[model samples]
Structure formats: C-alpha cells, structure tokens
Target: MSAITVIINPYANRGDSQHQIDAGLQALATSGLAFDIQLTEYRGHGAELAEAAARNGAEIIVAAGGDGTVHEVANGILRAAEGSEGVASATLGILPVGSGNDFAWGLGLDKGVDLAIDRLRRGQTRIIDVGYVEAEGFPAHYVVNILGGGFDSQVNIEAHKIMRLRGFAIYIVAVLKTLVIYYRNPHATIRFNDETHEFDMLMTFVANGPRLGGGFIAAPHARHDDGLFDICLVHKTTRRDMLLMIPKFMRGAHLNHPKVTMARAARVEIESPEGFPSQADGEIVGNDVRRMVVSLVPQRLRVIV
Candidate 1:
C-alpha cells in the first residue's frame, strides 16, 4: 500500500457510475493497493479532488474514469504543482473505465484495467511530454493528449449528445452527423516551424498522443516521449472526398493524402477570422476562439501505463 488517491467521476460511462466505482475498488483491493476513492460530486470536482490530494503529498493520483475526468485531474495536479516543490511529484495512474478512453488508448494502456493496475503496482513510471494552449480570451491550460479544432471538435460536440450509446458507436454516429451539419471549413493562418501557412481546413490537430475518437490514428508517427508534436492539418475537402477518406483516417493511412499536411513542430500559432470549434482531450474549449498558440511542455508528466 502506497499513498494514492482515486478520483472517480460518477457520471462516467453514462451508466451506473456507482457500480463502476465499487467494482474498481474491488479490483484495487485484490491488487493490494491501499486506496481511497472520492466520487466526484459535480462537474469539475475531479480537478478539486486531485489538487487537494497532490498538495497533501499524495504520491499517485488515479483518474478512475474517462478522458474528461483525466483532463480535469491533470489540470488540477499540474496547477497544484505549479511553483511548488515536491507537489508536482505525484505520478498519474489510469483505469480505462470510461467511454472511448482515448488517452489510455494512445498510451498503450487500453489493454485492460487489471493490466494497468499491475503496472501501477510495479511502480514503473514513464515521464511523458505535455502541451499547453494559449488563447486570447481563455486561460492558459495544459493538455496531455490532443488539442484540436475545426471539424473534429464539432464531432466531439455531437458525440457528447448521444446518451443512448457509448464509446466508438457514439463517435461514429457523431462523425456522420457532423459531416452533414458542419461542412464549411474555417479560414485560418497557422504559423509554426518558422513558416506561416494559410488555408481553409476541415481540422488541425496538435497531437501529443496518436489516437483520438477511440481508434482514429490522427497522428500515426506521434511518440509520447518525443519532444516534438505531430501536427496534422487537413485542408478543405468536398463532402464526397471527406466520406471517402474516413476509412483511410481510421487506418491512419491518410497521412500521405494530398489534402493532408503532416509536419512536426514544438510550437504552433493559429489565427482565424471566423473561429472554429476547439476541443482538448474530448472536452470543448471555447465556442469562438479566434486565435490560439499550442506549445510543447516536454516530459512534464510521469505516468504508469
């Protein structure tokens, strides 16, 4: 037994969250990890719990939910660790008990909850890279996986509404729904890698982890430890072309596509006259963000995967 705190979002999986939390505790008990679980009482509660735990010198904080839960907990831990000694030393652990679990998928932790617990018990740690988004009107924030905009964010917006379904099915339906409703590409200028390029794009992703939307390999070449980010820019395409390329994106074979631009950068700035949808780790950022700069925070997080 070590000093660990489990932050569980009761709303995760869109089902019986209490049952899920209980099951997780049961699993943890068998693993012999002395842990206490805190059920999130409301929105943004995960962050508060995480910050409190980290400030109290907890060694490990487990996000026992989905990507959104992980997002909030990471934000809390990073914020608490800011400008403090030994506070940021808390390593993160994940149990993929949420819809999609995209962050876990990218880290090769999508295997099973038992396996992740086993890894955690072993205390094996990997220090991975992180990202931060700086926008004009929004507070600066850290991102562990992907920070994306344009059509993909729209997909996230639609995907969150399908309460009847969970996981990849919901995303598939959302993708179809967005294709019909959100066909217009936002006009923008992306400045990065010492070059400024302007285009009307369906989406642009500043990727730290490779996969998103459960299985979409948006950045096939991305590595968590790599200081560089794999930036994927999809230029505007016709509706028919978009449909035709869906499978290619699923297989991560779209990198070589003509309309797709694959590049690596440590810093990127984007400006748009009319804002596009923005999302980080499957959560919507701002409704109308005109400008944003995404920069890499190298090896900022220690995780057990």
Candidate 2:
C-alpha cells in the first residue's frame, strides 16, 4: 500500500469542521503513517483531489468531512477506476466532521475523530454497497446512505434555509414547518422487480443505510452489502396519524405502522404526477421529478469501519 490522502472539506458542519482536520493530522502523526492532506477550496474539489491522489498511486483516499464530501470522493474514485486494471483500487476512509454523519453512523464510526483515524491507520477494509439515482434529464449519481422524494425532500430544502441550527434540531424544525404547510400527498407509481403499485405517498425513502436526518432510523433493516435497497413508502395519512408516527421513527419501529410499507429490491422506479422534490444524502436536487430509477452497486467501495 502507498501513502494515504486525506481530503478535508473545510466548509462542512457550518464551518465547525476546521478543528477536525487538526485532530486528524495529530492522530495520523501519532500513528506514524505516511500520508498527505489536502483541504478542499470549493465545491466538488474533494472529488477532484481524490481522483488525482488515486491516479498518483495513493492506496487510500480519506474523506475528512461529512456525507457529501464522502459521496463526492467515492464517486471520484469509482470514476477513475472505470476502465483500469483490477489491481489499481483505491480504498475510502472517513473522518466524520459533518452535522449529519449518516454514512459514518452506519459504519459505526461515531463522533470520535481520533478513534476513526486510528481505525484508518490500522488499515481494515470492508466491501460495501453503493446506490445510484437516475432521474429524467439529470445525470446519474451515487449516495452512500439514503435518498428520498416528496415530503422528505421538501423538508431537506426547508432545513437548509435556517443557518443557525444543525443536525436533528434543524430537521425537527423543518419537519414541523413542512407538515403544516406541505401536507398534500403526491401520486407515486412505483415498479420494483416484478411488482407494480401506485399510492398517494407523503414520502418515499430508498435507503442503503438505516439512518437519515441525524437520528431517524427510516429503514431499520438496510445494509450496505446486501445488494438491495430497503424502500420505505409513507402513504398519505391524517395530520394526527403522522404526528403519532413521528416518535416511532425515533425508535425505528415505524416500519410496523399500517401506513408505512417496506420492501427490498435490486431496482426500483418511481414516477410522480406532481413533480416532487428529491434528496440524496441530505442534498436537495430540486422539485418536480417525473421519474426516478434507483439501482444498487454491490461491493462497490472499500470502506474502513
């Protein structure tokens, strides 16, 4: 293995992540590993840096930011290896410095930067699945954790409108506001494998990992290497019913609710009549999506857990 390249997104966590870079460097130094660090100057810079590092013979490319940073880096590495020989694979590592480290939580990489760095230093790797979202008139993209459409996507957009809060608090406020103003269900026609169904759905979550929006375990049975995605559809419900189900999401027992339906599929397509918004890994991608096709990429990346 060659040297590790750590790509830090300085803008993550609303500028609270600068200290994590320092902590990561100190931990790497203590581990006596040969590595180089690069700070991303702008959006999508981490992906470029990771690609360059991999092409230059870097053994590992570490994303030292939040889920967005990790997603970009992973996409870069995968793109770089598209036609390359099998021997030239670059593994991915993560240092969770974002507000909602959803991917990190799935890998059991908690908030401790030093511990995460230590795990990277030890060089343990696991093969994990990745998800790709193909929408009409848009480029295909990857998400490490969860993706959603309809009400959840609206909530993601509204949450970012507030600049002062982070993580669960932002999501909570956004959900409350959206619930009051955006309660109409969108007509969604979904096709999964050999089955087809249509519903008036409040939201649809296609999950590769179990958690999203900080701590909401939206898909309790999702696993990255399962070669399938757990799709959760929340059908239109009364305001009182939705309010009652919100707490069950925290306990990860909402799947048992009658209004919620869960299914596992290798491929799923969703068509909505009202052109709803969509979100992947906490990033909102705009509104009125006519169609979305989600597929799984099995054992796509080597991740340190």
Which number leads on lDDT?
1
Worst 10 residues of 1 by lDDT: 15-24
List TM-scores for all candidates, in order. 0.95, 0.94
Predicted model with the maximum TM-score: 1
How many backbone clashes can be found in candidate 2?
A: 1
lDDT of 1 by residue, 1-305 (tens): 34989988878888545565676678789888788778888877988998889888888999988898898888888888788543258888897778878888888787767777777789888888888889889888888899999999999999888899977888899999999999668888998889988999789999998888877889998988899999999999999999988889899999989999999999999889899889999888876789999988787888887
Candidate 1 stretches with Cα past 4 Å from truth are 16-20, 84-87
Model 2 score (lDDT): 0.84
Per-model RMSD to reference: 1.8, 1.9
Cα-based lDDT for every prediction? 0.86, 0.84
Q: List the residue pairs that clash in candidate 2.
A: 275-288
Prediction 1 global C-alpha lDDT: 0.86
- Give residue 103's lDDT in candidate 2 (0 to 100): 88
Quick one: RMSD of model 2? 1.9
